[model samples]
Target: MSKSVDRKMSRGPSTEDIIEDTLPSTTETTVDKIEEISSLEKKLVRKIDLRLIPWLAILYLMLSLDRNNIGNARLGGLEKDLHLEGNDYYTALTIFFAGYVIFHIPSNLVVKRLRPSFWIAFTMVMWGICSLCQAFTHNAAGLIACRFFLGTFETGVGPSIPLVLSFWYQRDELALRVAIYFGSSTCAGAFAGAIAYGVLATMDGAHGIAGWRWIFIVEAIPTIILGLLSLVIMPDLPSSPNKRWLTPEERELAIQRTEMSGNTDKQFFDKKQFVAALTDLKNWLAVGIYVGLNVALGSYAVFLPTIIRDMGFASLDAQLLSIPPYVAACCLVFLISWNSDRTMERGFHIMGVSSLGALGYIFLLASESVGLRYTGAILVACGIYPIIPLTLSWVSNNQLGHTKRAVAIALVSMIAQVFAIVGTQVYRTEDGPRFIRGHAVCLAFISLSGISACVLRILLKRENTRRNQTYGPADVKDLSTLEDIDTLYDNHPQFRYAL
Candidate 1:
């Protein structure tokens, strides 16, 4: 858990308060809030939106499926199969995150430069191949190597997907869409368990390898196939598309819309702009929020199935039962996103959801009733999944320039994932069967998140008021261009930060 630290610099202006005051009052009006949707001419946005979700979802699904199949594998004797002892499995988990942190920033930069279609698909194939290699692990060293490569390949996909969504959708439309994409990861969690159950039921001892190996091998094949297919179907970008896939009219509309919003430019790396982005205290604040949330999330990801198995279900049945929490999460994600979009509010929605998650963890920590614990599981599934996408959309929407947004997104994501290493350690197998320590840890983190969301909202509100007083007019256009505004907010009068 985190304590409040006043990071105010004594010599300089209260940058925190200044940052708070920079949000535009125009953004606070109900009429302005309702306008995130396009005009009637573009009413078919949902139809096209539907097409985009499956590819993004499938991509995330496989990414999660492969990464977490280890939980299911653990049930099928993976530890024994690979002769793991002490903390070898936890070490493998930590190694994946180490590789994950190493590649995340560069991978995001590549996604910003190259086509998402090609680069993301390439990442998919690479991770899928590594996941398949997991099936061949005969020792701790082999598993570690495979997991490292798997993490290196999959590192970017999580951050890249939100970056890609920010490009196409407005701030309002993005939250729900992001939830849909992120929700798929929860679905993958469920699907992986269910699929693993099926795989184990039929092929327990059939292969030269164990049933755990079959889970990895079979799950991996679809990922590889999907990766290759994505190269063909994935949209390149709003600016540079495979001309064959889009009509000239659609391309023009994309460019024109971005220009109308005063943000049409390719993101390029610049040393000065990068430094300004890094310097913003809010950037680091956002990272802190995510790190706490992720530590809780990662604990659930790596240990929930194991926890269930300890609760009297057989190994296979434990795997099968893991499906419901994630399935419920998928539906809750869409519901929460829609509500957030309709209300055009991010902070409250996030606080509310995270609070629910904290409550779930508290329930698990306090009670021993199986039925009550199962309910807590459902609450955990629904509550945590929405925060990620909402938080991501909030960060991306508030950031002004393309280059700054790119780096900021990568930084938050990478910093958050660093906690995955911490999380993997917190929920050790020895803590199973009502992992009291694990539950308490997650509860503490979720409480931190609830507190942070309040801080961010208050900061945003104060900033919006200050911007109103300073700017003189809500419709000022002189500092509106992306290039001009890029460095203007760094103690400069010309730029205004968005809330």
Candidate 2:
């Protein structure tokens, strides 16, 4: 008996072991059969990216070109031609924001009420007309009128993009998509330089038109054409019936992917969320971050060529040198946003970059080295540009409902545009070359931005930690119903801020 038992044990369970090995366990089959939903999301995201990003990027490129061309036009002797004296030039720059700031909230709400494609495209054509009008201006008052209307129509595109992207992309995916189109604004800077050089150099006297006027005409036509093209290309929100491009299955997946991230409300307008957006502390904090960025951004856009010209370069060389900083900005904007998305982090990236912007101003204020000051200019662009998208996406990320997100995005934009108003005023005609006051003001605000970002991050992290412990870390499945989801908003114990 002992010999038989020893032989059986030595054979390692004999036939039973072989039989069990031949058949997979329940766990193994489940593991093998389990579907990867994220792969489908990637496919859908790629599809959305293809259909959306390119056209939007082109539109933004033109929008930015049209918006920032005034600065480039200044180099082409726009002020002298228009007889803009004293603060008149700054007033023209500042008035655009008046319309821009006033219309932001209304336009965002209007976007919700109208089909996004129709609304956005309509604005594009209108703004192009306004931009075209700038070419016909004979005085500062005429230019200011064109600029104000340009800002009014242009508002429907620039600040509204993040809100539109939010409807399609999840928080995890929002930043990069925001960067791509927004980054084109930086590309617009590069293009602005290159185009200004081209228009001023060759078209100075063409068709009996001044080169500055030529700049407006050349940039405005493409905008109108692209606007018409967008009707055929621009997509509506996934839930919108206008989304003919999406199949039923893919569309559902698109909606589902976004739903997994947060509230995917069916309503185009939510009064409650609108009220919440107005009242939310986060929106105001986001405004602070943006105020800082806009001050730097506004000054940088309108004054760079002048600053470079004051640095002893010829006007054309100054235009050419402006191209490099914008080129660097284009690269850094994409990389920073890519990394922000990759890590699912917003604040530290914002804080770090704002500090980098402040340091750039430091370089400007601290040293008179042409090389150092120029490098400071580059650093400022590299630093300031990335934060715009990051902060917009951050506000959009935290807001739970469509209306809230939309309203919050606009509110933050509306308030922040005021600083851009200040930005135009910062680099006064007298403050050429060093522009110590302008540089110092930028340094202070940008530094405030970095600090604000740090504090916001710490506060968000603490809230997230508290929720994780108390509510036990909610996931997509936690709030089982739409009612449950809508009511909770940010207060939902499971909702975590994208820190």
Candidate 3:
């Protein structure tokens, strides 16, 4: 019997032994678990997109319309009605951004402490009240007061959305999500023109009010309504009990996935993180790029109607014509951003788009043809609008901690708005019809943006290569266990930047 057993063992054991040998190893099991978690994460992302994106888009759309309706109001007799002479109209426009720039960092910090849902809603209500007051303003001072207060309340909404999005999305997923949110502002431009045309054409003297007054009153209603609705709709942080939309399991997954993606630290307001962000060279490069693009953006947003009117279109025709450039812009922004997310490249996309805008400005400066000028406006819109979200997401992508990201985004945006004061001042009354000086300044800025983007890309790529060479072959999977380690957030050995 012993000889028979020995013979069977020599024949490679029994069938059960072979079967056991074929089972997956520990590494394979881990890989399978990772794949399963990834699948679950994708599903979670889809659910989040459905619930969050559309409402945020609508909220931004309303906010954008309120902020920009002043441009449309300018076309609808706001200047003449309020007796805004010389630089008073421009002063009103400029002062809004003054308040806008001052409050951005503070507002972002407030969102970090309070629930974003409540804070955003509260600010929305305040801005809506301010917008409604614009309809009642009878003079330049009254309009400027309403504009300044309107900007103060609006500062929270713009920066807070990107900060909130960073909490939910990975860096790779952020560009398109931000594009959708920021792109809504472009849609609002188109909608603003259409709405302005309708109100000015139909409601010119309705109820003893001018068409421009009706624009302020009518636009404010939806903003106030949406503001109230946002209190119930906006999701809080993943760790908060106020996140009623997510299950306990989903919340755990949210936190784990975010941490695993290298957004490891979660302190509320770290001064160290703030100092780190302030010291980073990349943040300032990003700000320089944004300042260039936002100069064009601020100018286009506030002066499209006036520009179109100078092309010999009637007030009604100019308002209607303004719609097309913005519509084209909306489409281009979505296209570029979608490609940006897919290619996972930001610097080239920003540079190339800004170059396109610079070309458009050249067209405006060199030609007197109405058709050529209109085409220039379309190209400019397409180029400038997409850069807003891309540049913002770029800052968010490079920053490591929540507090760092908040400060970086707010600081860069605030700096850009400071330059936007220059933008508002460029299109002076003395330079109408052609606005040659304004076009020249915008072109210079856009060209500067393209150059900065190139330098930034090269610098980031070199840093990534240096890190890889120094670290050799580190395991990215080990990043999830970083809570046990004492490394600073985003400075982990295996944390690679998205170049």
Candidate 4:
């Protein structure tokens, strides 16, 4: 054995030592045990998918609806009803993100302590109440206040999904799962448009409430109900003693898979982990990538209805037309994310899709054709939507320690929300018709996001090369032991980044 291997063995009980001590010992039965464990792992993953992914996706669907329904409401005469003037409408959209940015890191830090199920459910209930309250807003001030508080309540939902998924899935399994969850945003956009179309058309002035008010009231009902249901349905960590849904063997297998994938077992918040995440160059690079992508995301989510309206479609038709692009985006995100996982690549997928978004913007800038502009819209949706889950999973995959991953994810998301504040302001009323300025800004940011992905990929590749030279090639089977010995997360010698 090498001197480093000898030192690792001498320091304390390796993960292998613990596993050997705990597991059944029988030389003739070793292959049988391995086969049994593999079967159990398959069963566990299927259970996790059935129980976890659908509920999370539904929750995120509500979140996306509550967040972006303002755009739909605007088309349904919210601005006229509230007497919104000048930049008041845009300011309301922008202010929500201020609350969103403020609470991300703090909310994520508390997830483990408070437990994800309770914390997520509580926040969902609060956001649902806030969304419902939007129906009663009599003025721009009232609307903005509801939006800000809604942002505050909904802060943890987005970042927490990826964090929770990381606990259950290996790195390779994460992107697709995240895509499945985040794809709900695209679905939300489509669903919101369809619902808004029906509500505005059929429910206008019903019970003396405007169509816009009905939109808020009706959408808020499902959100509030699901929030209540989540308390019972959502699973906590695999290691939680209270997780009655998981069999003892299944729970052990879940924890074992995570550890074997090189994720640390640390569950509590650590200041040192926070500091390491803050200081990491890769984390900042991820922040840059997310900022650019989210700027485009924030703009599209909030303005697609208005942008479609500018294409000479009637208000109702505009809302309905918005659904197709998001549908396209939703379909494309699954395919792209599945391919990303199948190939074990992230940066190129991000860069390529972001470039597709930029091209869509270019088509918009260069053409006056309605069909071409609509196609541009589809491309833009396809480009930015998938990149959200892909980039999020990329950051989660690279970060090892649970606390560090939590902090790093929150920090990256917070910075993206900050940029989203700016993104919201880009589509000003005065710049309407073509909204050339908004398109240009989105194109520029998308390009920047693609560039950031390339840089990050190259940097990680170089680091992986250097680590291999210094410590030899990583042994996939020995990751659990390496994780225990290397306290520094991804900085460990045996940790090879998925570039």
The top-ranked prediction according to lDDT is 4
Residue-level lDDT of model 1, residues 1-499, one tens digit each, is 0111111110111212222233355756344333322332164345347657778988898898888889889988999989999989999988888888888777767886878888988989999999999998899999999999888899658778887777666555778888888889998988888888898988978847689999999999999999999888887666775655445755654544444333554446666657767887777777867887888888788678887877778888888889898898788888988887666666787788888888788778888888788788778877788888878877776675666677788888888889867778887667678889988888888777777777887786566556546853233332234345545533333333333
TM-scores for the candidates = 0.88, 0.92, 0.91, 0.94
Q: Ranking under lDDT, best-scoring first? A: 4, 2, 3, 1
Please list the residue runs of candidate 1 whose C-alpha ends up more than 4 Å from where it truly belongs after superposition.
1-44, 476-483, 489-499
Residue 77 C-alpha lDDT in model 4: 91
What candidate 4 gets wrong by more than 4 Å, as runs, is 1-26, 265-267, 476-480, 483-486
Q: Write the per-residue lDDT of candidate 2 for residues 168-218, one digit (tens) a residue.
A: 876667889999999999999999999999999999989999999999999
Of the pair 1 and 2, which is ahead by TM-score?
2
lDDT of 2: 0.83
Tell me the deviation in Å of residue 494 in model 2.
1.7
lDDT of 1 at 25: 53
For model 4, residues 1-499, the per-residue Cα lDDT tens digits are 3434422321222335335534677775485666665567678889999889999999999999999999999999999999999889988999899889899988888887888899999999999999999999999999999999999999769888889888888777888999999999999999999999999999999999999999999999899999999999999887778667888888887777776665655647777778999999998988888998989999999899999999999999999999999999999999999998777788899999998999999988889999999999999999999998899888988887778888989999998899988789888777877889999999999998899999999998788768767888665444566644446777877677777
Q: Where does candidate 4 have its weakest 10-residue lDDT segment?
A: 6-15
Q: What is the lDDT of residue 153 in candidate 1?
A: 91
lDDT of each: 0.74, 0.83, 0.82, 0.86
42-127 per-residue lDDT for model 3 (tens digits): 67788789888898999999989998899999888898999988889989989999889999998988896888889999999999
RMSD of each: 7.4, 9.8, 9.6, 4.3
N/CA/C clash count, model 1: 7
Query: Lowest summed lDDT over 10 consecutive residues: which window, candidate 3?
Result: 6-15
Q: In model 3, which runs have C-alpha deviations exceeding 4 angstroms?
A: 1-36, 478-480, 483-487
lDDT value, residue 212 of candidate 4: 98
Candidate 1, residue 275: CA error in Å? Answer: 1.2
lDDT comparison, 1 vs 3, better candidate? 3
